[model samples]
Target: MKAAVLFEAKQPLSIEEVTIAKPAAHEVLIRTVAVGVCRSDLHFVDGAYPHAMPTIPGHEAAGVVEAVGEEVRCVKVGDHVVTCLSAYCGQCEYCVTGRMSLCIDAAVRRPKGAPPRLMLGDVPVAQMLNLSAYAELMLVHEHACVAIDRDMPLDRAALLGCAVTTGAGAVFNTTDVTPGETVCVVGCGGIGLAAVNAAKIAGAGRIIALDPVPEKRAMAEKLGATHSFDSAAETVADEVVALTRGGVHHAIEAVGRPQSAATAVKVLRRGGTATILGMMPLGEKVGLSAMDLLAGKRLQGGLMGSNRFPVDIPRLVDFYLRGLLDLDTIIADRLPLDRINEAFDELRRGETTRSVVTFG
Candidate 1:
């Protein structure tokens, strides 16, 4: 199989002939159909986040099951599925507590001394996250994937794995956004735009979308934002507060920047909550004032939207099929595996909502 392999930080990923091992117990092998070029992958490739070298960088993906281990019962051969990075061990404390996204059990991966799942000649290639979906095929734990309806298009289904799940899940699960709530979303990228769409579905009384890019702000309005502001004006937070009388009930930060995260806190009403969904730098810190906390303003971080993939994804599929979720507008371009570098270039420029890699 051919895969895009990252050898060094801030370097281009090279296309190489890689070898994929068969499924281990509780693992599944999938034929990659569509993989979204997400901003999270850029975090590792551009050295914003540290990762093991010689790894395959991709996680947001949708594919068809080609094979499964003897103990795998969640999906069968030929079943369509979406892959997630939040793989869990069913017996973990977090899993039993209904917080499966926080499960960090080491047993989810093969035991030490076991053969690698991916190899380039004789050297082992570390898999990015749990599902290295940048390749022609992926071998991952069954818990990392959820089977979805076959009618969902693979390219659109790929978005549900990460951007959609993280964005919408933050609204539906992480924050208590009531039907009449006011929402202000920072950054109009894939994740931010999804939050705007979900706010509309949640019946937000007013949805304000903020971004420096005019194109993205326009896109946010088309998706569902009642108001859009260009952060370049240098008054996004004030504009949001002004539009909603005092401040919004919920403010979501999706850019992963310290400033954007701070703005999420600035645009919240009393007793409102700010959910930070973007993956910020490892050592960076976001600051908030003591007065804000005293007023009952809450700032929180969400991992993979604190998702329970097994239940959330199928219902998300239903939302898409019913024309509630806007996957069609989310896709900006579709490229082949060999052109992965160009896809990342576009991502860095924030030129597109999402670029998808379609396999043959």
Candidate 2:
């Protein structure tokens, strides 16, 4: 299999041939079709996030199941599926209680001391997430994927594997935005645009999109944002509050940062809830005033849109098929696997929304 391996922080991923292990009883093997580039991957690339080196760095992907382990029944060989890094152990307290995203036992990847999923000769390469979709193949636990309609294009379905689900999920499941409400999403990247579209579908009376990039802001408007702005300047929250009369019913922080997290909090109405969808650094603290809690403002984090993939992925696919979800527009371009380095280059230059690497 061919994979783009991360060898150093702030360095380009090098393409290399690697060996992919087969599936275990609880796993499935997939022939990778399309993998979407993500900001989280960029964080690890730029040293903003920490991880083991020589990693196969990709999670958002869609492909066809080539084989399944003995115990796997959700999908079969020849079934098209979208891969998720979320592997939930059904027996966990969180999983049993409906908060599957918080299932501590699930998504507990391979044991720490074991050989990683990808390897170059004898050199082990860790997977960025449980699903190392950057490669031509993936051997992942069955719980880390959801079977989708075969007709959905692999490129678009790949977004559902991560950004789409994370963004739309935060709005639909986490914050539970109600109709006639107002929303402000800070960051007009892929996730932020998904939030804006989700907000529109949720019947939000006002949707404000904020970002430092003009192209992103424009894209957000096309995705259903009623207004857009350059958030590079401060006072964005104040502007949002002023425009919404009092404040928005909900705010989403899609950029992983303390400033954006705080801004997501500051722009809400008295009882409004803020959902931080951004993947914040592992140990970095999000400063919040103790007084804010007393004021009835709430802050919460979400993982993978708090998704139950079997249910959500299908609904998202239907939405896309029915012309509700905008995957084609969101996909700025597609590149062959060998051009994986170019995909990352476009991401760094902010030249595209998502650059999917296709198996060629």
Candidate 3:
């Protein structure tokens, strides 16, 4: 199998021939169909988070199941599936509590010193978030993937794995915006735009989409934003407060930055909540006023939009099929594995919503 491996930070991802392993008892083998190039992948390439060297970087993906382990019952061979990073161990405290997104059981992956599920010749390269859809094939825990309708295109289904799940989940699950709620999303990338679309679907009275890039603001309006801001203008928070009678019902910080996180907290209404969906660097903290927090406002975080992927994905696919969800508009480009470097470069520029690697 051929895969694009990260050789260094901000460098080209080298395409190489690699061997992928078969599934274990609780895993499945998927032949890559299409994988969305996500911003989260860039976080690893740029060293935002520490990952093993020569890693395969891709998670937002949908592919066909080539094989399944003995323990797999949810899907069968030749089934079209989308992968989710939030693998849950059903017996964990979090899973039993219906907070499976926070499941921390050791059932998914083995600890260090144990044999890995994937290998490159003699070297054991890490799989980013466990999906590794950049390669021609992937082996992942059965719980980490969900089967979608065959009618939905694999390329579009791939985006639902991450961007759509994160963006829509943040709105429908985490924040629970009422019909008349006012929302402000801090970034207009894939997840941020998803938030805008979700806000529209949620019937937000006023949706303010904020991004430094003026062009994304335009895209946001097309998606569902009632108003869009460049965010480079004077004070973004002040502008939101002025637009809304008081403060926004919810403020979402999709950009993983300390300043944007703090800004989300500051702009919420007296009892509103701010949902942080970005994967911020380890040990970084966002500061907030104690007085404001005491006023009943709250700060929260969402992992995979607090998703139950198996159930949520099918419904989203239905939403897309019925013309409620718009995957056709968000896709910007589709390239091959060899062009992975170009895809990463385009991501750094914030040039488009999503780019997918379509396997031949």
Candidate 4:
């Protein structure tokens, strides 16, 4: 199997002939179909986030189950599925309490001393976030993926894995915006666009989309934003407050920058919550001002959009099929796996909404 292998930080991933092991107990092997090139993966590639070397980094993906371990029952050999990074151990407190996204149990991976799931010759290749979909195939815990309706196109279904799940899930699960509420989404990339679309579905009275890029702002309006703004403008915060006549009911930070997070907090109305969906720099801190805290403004992180993948993903698929969610508009380009680096380059340029790497 050929995979893009990242041997070190701040370096390009090289295509290599990697070997994939068969499924272990509770694991499933999937034939990669389509995977989204996300900024999160770029974070690791650029060393914004640290990870073990010689790892395969792609995560947002959908594929067909080619095989399953003896104990795997959630999916069969022929099922179509979407892979999620938030693999959970059902017995963990987080999982039992309905917070499956927070589960960090090691049971999902092979025990120490066990043979590696992937290898390049004699060296082990670390898997990124449980599902390394950049490769031709992926071996992951059954809990990391959920079978979806076959009718859902695998390419679009790939978006549901991360960008869609994180963005839409933040609206539906994290903030729970009520009808007539105002929402301001920072950044108009894949995640931000999905939030805009979900805000519309949630019946937000006013949906504000912010991005430095004019094209992205226009895309946001096409999806659902009632207003669009240049995020790089000096008075963007003041503009948002002025347009809303005070501040928005919910503000989402999807750019993963300190400045963007601050803008999200700045645009929130009293008692409003700011959900940070982007993965910021590891040591960076985000906080509300003392005055804002007194005003009941709150800030929180929405990891993987507080997802419960088994339930949320299938419903998301239905939403797309019903034309309620616009995955089609979010996708900007589709490239073969070998051209994965070009997709990342576009992301660095902040010129595309979402780029997908498709396998044969």
Candidate with the larger lDDT of 3 and 4: 4
Question: Can you write out model 1's per-residue Cα lDDT over 4-84, one digit (the tens) per residue?
Answer: 999999999999999999999999999999999999999999998888889999999999999999899899999999999
Candidate 3 residue spans exceeding 4 A from truth: 110-115
lDDT of 2 by residue, 193-305 (tens): 88899888888889999888888888999999999877877878888889988788899999888788888888888888888988787787775577677778888888889
- The collision pairs in model 1 are none
Which runs of model 4 end up more than 4 angstroms from their true locations? none
Candidate 3 lDDT tens digits, 162-245: 999999989988888899989999998889888898889889999999888877889899998999877767688888888887
* Ordered list by TM-score, greatest first: 4, 1, 3, 2
lDDT of 2 at 62: 91
TM-score of 4: 0.99
Among all windows of 10 consecutive residues in model 2, the one with the lowest summed lDDT is 106-115
Candidate 1 local distance difference test against the native: 0.92
> Which residue pairs show collisions in model 4?
none
After superposing candidate 1, which stretches have Cα over 4 Å from the reference? none
Of the candidates numbered 2 and 4, which has the greater TM-score value? 4
TM-score of every candidate relative to the true structure: 0.99, 0.94, 0.96, 0.99
Q: TM-score of predicted model 3?
A: 0.96
